[model samples]
Target: MAHTPFKSVGMVGLGKMGGAMAKALVSQGTKVFAFDPNLKETSVEGVTLVSTLETLASEAGIIVIAVKPNLVEPVLAEFQKPAIFVSIAAGISYSQLVAKTPQGSTCVRVMPNLPLVANRGAMGYFCEDQAVAHVERLFYGLGDSFRVTKESLMDAVTGLSGSGPAYVLTFLQAMAEGGLQEGLSYEESLGLAMETIEGTLVYFRQLRRKDQNLHPMEVRNWVTSPGGTTIHGLDALERGGFSTAVRDAIRRATERSKELGKG
Candidate 1:
C-alpha cells in the first residue's frame, strides 16, 4: 500500500533528539511546526514555533512526540486532531501511545540514539503495517533504521543500539589511553583512535554491503597475522574479558528497559 508523505511535521519537544530531527526535516525541505513550553530559543532554522500542541496538530499531518516518557500522556491529551504520531520517547510502547491518543490514530514508537544529532543515528521502531512507510520516510536522512516484527524486541534494540554509543565512546577513551601509554601525546592519541574507529567502520560497512554473509571476526582475522601485534592485542582484550563485559552491559540494559516499560 502506498502511503502519502506528510505535508507538514509537528514537533512537540525541542531537546537534543527533537531539535536534531527538526533540523534534519527542515533540511529535506519539509515544513516543520515546533512547540516546546520549556524552550525560549531554538537553534534550528526553518521551523515555525507554535504556542501550543493544539496549534501544531491543526497544521501538521504528522506529529512527532519527542518529549520525555513521563510527559507523553499529558502532551497527547493536548492534541486536538488526529495525526500520524511518531514517538522517540524511550520505554514508551505503541499500545501506551495508542491508549493516550484519539481512537483510530496511528502510533509508532521509535528508539533513536544520540548519534542522531549528526544525521548518523541508528533507530529501531515498531508500528502497525499501515504506518511503516510513513515512519521510514520520517527518519530517512536521519540515519539507519530497523523495523522490528514485535514491539517487545524494541527493548532489546534499546539495550543494543540505543545504549551502544556510550559503550563505544568508553572503548574509544580506553583506546586513546592505550595510545597515550605508548608515548603518544593526548591530542594525537585521541585523534588517531577516533580516525581508526571511523575508518574501520566505513570499511566494515562496505564489506557487509558487498557480502552480507561476511562476519566481523573474518575482518579481524584479515588484519591479524600468524603472530602479530593485532593478535597480541586480541589476546590482551580476551584476558581482560572485553567481549564478556560488552555482552553483560547489553544484557543489563535490556533488563532495565523491560522494567521501565512495566512502570
Candidate 2:
C-alpha cells in the first residue's frame, strides 16, 4: 500500500539516536520541527527548533518520541495531537503509548539499536496496518527495518538486535585480546579484528544477495582444511560451548525484555 508522504516531522529528543534520525530525515528532504529543552540549538539543516511540544505538534504531521522509556509517557502527555506517533523508547508497548495520546491517534512502537547513530541500525516495529508503510518509510533512512506481526516478538527483537551490539563488541574485544597474546600490538589487533568481522559480514551479505542457501558452517568448512589453524580455533570454540553460550545470552536478554515490558 502506498503511504502518504509526510510533509513535516516532529522530534521530541535530540540525543545521539534522535539527532542522527533528525539529520537523516532532513537529508531525505522532509521538513522537521523539533523540540528538545536540553538543547539551545540543533545545528542540523532543515530542522526547525520549536520552543514547545505544542508548537511542534501544530507544525508537523508525525511526531517521533525519542526520549528514554521512562520519559515517554510524560512526553506523550504533553502533545496529545492526533498525529502518527513513532516511538523508539525501549520496552514501551503500543498500548501504553495509545493510552497517553488522544483518540484516533496512531502509535507505532519500534525497537532500534545503537547502530542507528551511523544510519546502519536494525529496527523492528509493530503498528496497525494503516501505519506500516508510513513507519517503514520513516525508519528506512536509518537502515533495514521489518514489521513485527505479533507485538510479543518485539521482545525477541530487543534481545537480538537491540542488545546484540554489546555482545558483538565483547566478541571483538576477545578476538583482539587473542591477537595480542600472539605478539600483535593492541591497536593492530583491534584493527584486524574489526576488519575481519566487517569483511566477513560483507561477504555473507553478498552471498545472500546471490540467493545462495549455504549455511555459515558450510562457508567455514570451505576454509578449514584438515589440521589447519582454523580447525584448532574451531575445536577450542566447541569445547568452550561458544554457540550455546551465545544462544543463552540472547535467551536471557529476551526474558529480561519481557520482564521490563510487564512493568
Please, what are the lDDT tens digits per residue for candidate 1 over residues 1-263?
55344568999999999999999888887899999988777778898898977889888978999998889888898776677899988788888899889877899999999999999999999998999889889998789999999999999999999999999999999999998999999899999999999999999999999999999999999999988889999999999999999999999999998888777
Cα lDDT tens digits, model 2, 1-263, are 65444678999998877888888888777888899999888877778899998899899878999998889988998876598999987788889999998788989999999898889999999999999888888986688998989999999999999999999999999999999999999999999999999999999888888777868887888899999999999999989999999999999999988887777
- Runs in model 2 with CA error above 4 Å? 1-5
TM-score of candidate 2 to 2 decimals: 0.94
- Name the runs in model 1 displaced over 4 angstroms: 1-5
For each candidate in turn, the TM-score is 0.96, 0.94
How much does candidate 1 score in TM-score? 0.96
C-alpha RMSD values across all candidates = 1.9, 2.0
Each model's lDDT comes to 0.90, 0.89
RMSD in angstroms between candidate 2 and the native structure over all alpha carbons: 2.0
